[model samples]
Target: MSHGVNNVRSRWTLPDYKPTQKYENAYRVTARFLLWVEKTKNRKVVDKLDAALRDGTYQPEMWVKLTGLTVDQLWKEYGDDPALALTYK
Candidate 1:
């Protein structure tokens, strides 16, 4: 995946590097999810998951247990991009 860009010396070399359209779309979707998290506030469910992840105690079942929501539902609330529908599972 490095594709020789990891140690490139100059910013001009950046333009020579490009991901495929598939990767570009994936990046955009991930960015959208990140932006949603950044913009959202006072989300108690996400906060709990974040804390669990940071503390190394996160469990897949917690998605339903704590939030009373499926992973897909949480993702929908976060961004709900169609491209991300298959992302949760």
Candidate 2:
């Protein structure tokens, strides 16, 4: 995701940016779950997440409220699904 973000930055002539990768795996898992949510529960969930994040009000409970799934449940359901893998073209 940071890779993609950097690509966008380069396209816009912004400075090259590198976000920390210490939580890459966590980011990937959360991304997969979000993809699942967008696929099965709410098509605008990513947008909602972005909005909440931008407002500094994002919370894990938001996922529960949106899909009735806890973080653990989301992981169990979508963690190993290759179809939801985060990919950059």
Global lDDT of each candidate: 0.47, 0.59
Residue-level error in angstroms, candidate 1, position 19: 22
TM-score of each: 0.37, 0.53
Per residue, candidate 1 scores C-alpha lDDT tens digits across 1-89 of: 22233334532222211222221345444444433443443246657877999999999888678656655565566543322221111
Q: Which candidate is the best by lDDT?
A: 2
Residue pairs with backbone overlap in model 1: none
What's the TM for model 1? 0.37
The per-residue C-alpha lDDT of model 1 at residue 21 equals 24
**Candidate 2 residue-wise lDDT, 14-58, digit = tens:** 121123221135655445456666777788888987999999999
Off by over 4 Å in 1: 1-42, 76-89
Best by TM-score: 2
